[model samples]
Target: MTFVEELREHAELAGAPLPQLSDGRDRYGPVAAILFAQRSFASVRRRSNGTTLVTVWDHRGELAAWGQAPAVDDVVNTLRAWQDGVPLPELCSAVARYLQAGDPAAAIETLWSVLTDDGEPHLHAIVAAASADPTLRALRPWVSHGTLHLLHATDAVHGVRRGLAFHPTDEDAFKVHVYDGPIGPVQDVASAAATAAATAATW
Candidate 1:
């Protein structure tokens, strides 16, 4: 089968089906954009004598990350996993890590998975609490090495960004530091979500 046809079949199994290629060719080769939930996510290209190139974009649609896989099937499987349950920040960061280091292990151990692996349920709690408000949904949360960061789709120059350093002052309170800058304890994820929503509107 041709490249596009094979991609479509694999994507169908992945449950994320392929869309029509826009018929655009760039310096690399023929390119097709992929959207998830109607938002721009990644691109697939045939390049350098039929090699597959997968490029991932940041929320602002900037050139932020890329991943080179052996074939379209590898890309499709990753996409399927991302679609199944991975958070946006994690998905983006995985591609970002791979492109940055050219290491698949780095991608797996980077922002998202690092935060999720602690077995403490912080990622789940934070996400569940954040989901209480839809506006806060715009804020994408990512974590790395004890630090949590946020991103927004409308972000242009740097992408909607926030950072927090969590240090528990007491059982009921944890000191949280903001990316723009911070002070005081957040106490819980709901407060953090509200703070994120308010900040996303203006900051």
Candidate 2:
């Protein structure tokens, strides 16, 4: 079956029925629905080129992007990679550094491996939170907040705790947050990284 057809069929099976595209081009929403069906803590996004990306969080709680092509075979392959816990390409891993440095284009290209090199930490780490808690697994599409976040509910008082956070303020600037505690170390790191990168860029 074609990639679009397979997505439609799979989405039906999962009872998430996706909307039909008027021009029949592959869109992020439907693709996301298929990948996220019955599964949470992961998101699928549409690239400018119309390719679909499957996103998860790495061990460090950074966005780990995968699933570039979105062809029927590619979608199936990416899903299998996730299910089997395969590592992302080595080049894909560079996105974390790119993001930390406040480079969205570089990060996106890195995740897509546009230039090709190798990607992310173990895919398992990205999915672990959901795997351990059904409540988490039901969170769907994970709020983008401009960048991807790996979140889990810690305690009732604490609410949702994010391991990593990416905030895109604009095309020219963005922020990356990484932490040890619920929110302390991350705020400091994010502030420092943004200031440092911005300072360096001015020179």
Which candidate has the top score in TM-score? 1
lDDT per residue for candidate 1 within 1-203, as digits (tens), equals: 66656767888886776564333432222354343523445556554565555655445544444556676677775555444555555654663333343333333233232233221344455544544556544444444443344555344335444433444343334545666576655576666556656655575
Looking at model 1, residue 57 earns an lDDT score of 46
Best by lDDT: 1
Question: What lDDT score goes with residue 83 in model 1?
Answer: 43
Q: For candidate 2, write residues 39-123 as lDDT tens digits.
A: 2233444456676655544543344454455354444444444434554552234222111223433343333332112112222
CA error at residue 141 for candidate 1, angstroms? 27
Badly placed stretches (over 4 Å) of model 1 are 14-33, 36-39, 81-85, 92-203
Q: Give the TM-score of candidate 2.
A: 0.32
Against the hidden reference, what TM-scores do the models get? 0.37, 0.32
Each prediction's whole-model lDDT (CA): 0.49, 0.37
Task: State the lDDT at 52 in candidate 1.
Answer: 59
- Report how far off residue 56 is in candidate 1 (Å): 1.0
